[model samples]
Target: MKNKSLYLYSFNQRKGIFLLLLVMIFTQAIYFFWSSNTTPQKDKENHQWLALQSHVDSLKQVKEEFKPTIYPFNPNFISDVKGYRLGMSVEELDRLFAFRKQNKYVNSAKEFQSVTGVSDSLLAVISPYFKFPDWVNQPQKEYVKFENKISDVKPKTKIDINLATQEDLIKVYGIGPALSERILKQREVLGGFASMEQLAFVWGLNPDVIENVNKSFAVVSTSGIKKIKINDLSIKELSKFPYFNYTIAKEIVTYRSMKGDIQNIEDLTKINGFPVEKLKFIALYLEF
Candidate 1:
């Protein structure tokens, strides 16, 4: 009876082990089937998302290509929206409106920039599209003298740009009344131009206009310029100059306080944010 009972126990143990192994194999097959089906579905969905993103990017590129184009218009007639579209700041637009309110017209590109205070780079971009009145485009009539006898012709006297009034400046080919006034205003602010090269610093003077100005005028005498003493002036005072902004003025004052008196242009170059390329021009307004 004991041997029969032991034999039955061994057979039951083997049967249980076989059943567990079969169950494990079935579970692993189901897992493999699920993984294989879901992986392809996930990959397809991922591909669709990538394709959608690419389509969106292509649409954006097309939209960029279809951006609105700009056309020529009179700057004098520019409204707030028009000026905004042209990349003008609020202050610049306000200045234009203010000038226009006085029943004045911006006749030339240079005059437009003078009134608006736009940068040269921006002026270059937009000036090509500026339109003027018919009268401005008309040629002036020149009278020729009929001389009976040959005589020595006196050379035309070159006008001094530093001392030239607005009227004198207007006599130049490209300079109008507004541009003349702007030039005079710039000269007044600088006290005087140290050299003819300093004309390049004038806000709205184009290269061609500058050339005309140089031909007609010379920087024969400098106005009595009040030079700022670098060591003595406060940051506020220094910042008042055209070349020095508040940040650069503060930095200069701090550097001076820390290192003592700035000896020369070389010393100023050591200060952070100093306008190194413009030092020669700026030095005309400053004293060491």
Candidate 2:
């Protein structure tokens, strides 16, 4: 009985306590060993990541040792890698890409800057190497220079595009009854043409046809225009605009409702999908 109890604990009870302690210590030692091995792997990964980050940082800090030879390039066709090589950042490249996707050409360095918003210093460095199509650079300059003598001049009065009849429009090279009708329809919808440039947007009129129309007719007068008041315009009412589609009308209404009245070209330009390029011409046809 004395052996069974040593300070209120029996022999079996002491053995059970000793075994429990040994098990606890054994599990602790095993866990320590496992963690020590796994910790080194985690540390190795962390060290590798830091080393790679350091390498990237060093690369960023270093400047180009030599400038690459820049051949004459059409600024219109600049690719991502080409833009990067030309010192254009991603944002500038993206803007230019968006412009080109609309089938518009950048005719001059000034236009390029307007579209891309590139830095002037960078533009100066790159503009010298820009080569454009002959038509853009000159309209047969050599031919015109060779023959200095002027041809027989016939003074033809330019007709106003807004008031031109179907017969008058048909006199242009490519405008037939169908095209003339379409132009008149467009004029009726928009109240009047703001400029001769609006002829380019007429359906079925190509560049050559537009040029012909411009030579024959012009937007001589802008008076009596049926301009839409856009500040309180409903989506349907705004959608009736020649340029604004249903989607754009909805967005405009949404923008107006949320942000307040669209006061001017600057406010319209801030809209998510408004075409900022044609804002000047667009502003002419809209009533404040």
Best by lDDT: 2
Model 2, 193-281: lDDT tens per residue? 88777777776676877987888888898774777889968999899887888988899989988998888878888787886766777
* Cα error, candidate 1, residue 155 (Å): 4.9
Compared with the true structure, all predictions reach lDDT values of 0.84, 0.85
The per-residue C-alpha lDDT of model 1 at residue 281 equals: 74
Supply candidate 2's per-residue lDDT for 249. 89
29-102: candidate 1 lDDT, tens digit per residue: 99999999999999999999999999999999999899577898889999989889889999999999999888
Stretches of candidate 2 above 4 Å error?
Answer: 1-154
Error of 2 at 176 (Å): 1.3
TM-score, one value per model: 0.51, 0.47
Q: Model 1, residue 9: what's the lDDT? A: 61
Q: In candidate 1, which residue ranges exceed 4 Å CA deviation?
A: 1-72, 75-130, 133-155
